[model samples]
Target: MKQAVIFAGASVQPEQQPPVPAADLYVCADAGVKLAQALGVVPDWIVGDFDSLGSVPEGENVEPFSPMKDDTDILLAAKYALSKGCRRLVFYGALGGRLDHTVANLQMLRFLADHGAQGVLVDHAHWVTLQRGGTAVYPRRDGMYFSLFAMTEQCEDVTLEGVAYPLCHGKFSNAFPLGVSNEILAENAVVTVGRGDLLVVYARD
Candidate 1:
């Protein structure tokens, strides 16, 4: 059961990076090499098309791809992590900067979920993940905001606990953001989905 951490291009400065996990491997995707280096991280592999890299990093394990590829660099790095038998994947630098890239990384979370590998996009201010037919629980904290969106067309039998607006066996629609801007009121909060998928966004602002 190996774990992996991937650094992406759309991120903040190294000094402002989040607390990273201790994993078997660390990866750099395109411009992520810069972030990795700035944080004094020697990644096990450097992956991407090298377009945003400016200059190829000095490394032996470089997995280069074409600029015309279908997947984004972060997704490519995630695939590499899966190929190496990683069961848990955490992505940094996948959020912030461009809205399109952030959306793309959310899709990568779906890919990880479909493959039975858990993945999350994390930063100092936000933590995002995908949930499908499962339950996700968190230790509730005051001033933190939690929201859920239907990842599929709709999420069925959704349950919420310990939140300002709690729901039990509720249905959420992608066309509507009915589950937005909720706050904690207890020690713990749980979100359960009996059908479909949900995009969970937890933020502290």
Candidate 2:
């Protein structure tokens, strides 16, 4: 798979770093360069307005955008990744710090899904992704909490198996968090969404 790994937002704690897989492309969003360096990754491209970075970084790899831009720095980085033909994107440091930014990243994942790609937001303690009207199987994690939410107004014919609380063809709504804090019971969990999008999250304590 052609994958891109992007660094954005606050630096992750050393102990909280997940097992990051190697990607074909790497990108940093402004101040995210600091976190990229911490991870020993040399970004192929750096995209941002330089506001968070204090000053424009002196490098030919840096792709500076105006601060008055409509999209966020991370979103710009995502666009660059897509332009490079990367369909699987993993974003580090995309959570925490500002609550609004975290929400924005989630929206970015939805955007990727709409564009025939998939994005995963990795933070200090969470692995989040989006599922669009399809089936997904997740490997069982002994102590982790698995949760799913309706990203659209309604997700119809949602089925969940191999979890502590199983659902059969249930209609999920964004208005209610009915799929929160479930645990994987079988060797793997199967989630099928007949319509609409689903926001899936795996959290560690």
Candidate 3:
């Protein structure tokens, strides 16, 4: 499957990182250029204000935006990638920056999901993604903690298994945080939602 990988400007620890995997397109958001280059990525597009770059790199691959624009640089890069027909996308350096930017980046995952693409937000302590409605199976990581949160008004018939606390056919709402900090016990864990979508956060302290 053709996919895109984007790098943003967020603080990240070396050890607690997730791989961006192979992608058909590589995009960088301002300072994200450094991270992308460090990962040996040749970006097809560099979308952002030239501030982080000192000056725009000389290439047709560059897409400059006004720093004062309403959208964040990373969001702009993502939209561009999607427009170019990338269906599966993953982001690095997208969290741990300004709190508001981090939250906005997470919200972008929902936008991608609703538009028929998959978006994953990978950071030092967690890997997060939005599920419109489906099952997600995860291979266990010893120190990882799993949590589920309703992304819409409500998520119905949620089920979780192979974890320390298992639930069946549960309903969750945005008003309350009913699923948070559950342990992974075995080789794998499965989460299923019968209606609506939820945010699945696989985290560690």
Best candidate, lDDT: 2
Tens digit of per-residue lDDT, candidate 3, span 150-180: 9889999989899898999989999999889
The global Cα lDDT (0 to 1) of model 2 is: 0.90
Better of 1 and 3 by TM-score: 1
TM-score of each model, paired residue for residue? 0.95, 0.97, 0.92
lDDT of 1 by residue, 100-191 (tens): 98888888888898888988888778888888888878777556698889989999999999889999999999999999888878788888
Q: Is candidate 2 or candidate 3 better by lDDT?
A: 2
Clashes in candidate 2: how many?
0
Q: Stretches of candidate 3 above 4 Å error?
A: 13-16
**Which residue pairs clash in candidate 1?**
none
Candidate 2: worst-modelled 10 consecutive residues by lDDT: 11-20
> In model 2, which regions exceed 4 Å deviation?
none
- Using alpha carbons, what is the TM-score of model 2? 0.97
lDDT of each: 0.87, 0.90, 0.85
Ranking by TM-score: 2, 1, 3
Number of clashes found in candidate 3: 0
What is residue 120's positional error in candidate 3, in angstroms?
0.7
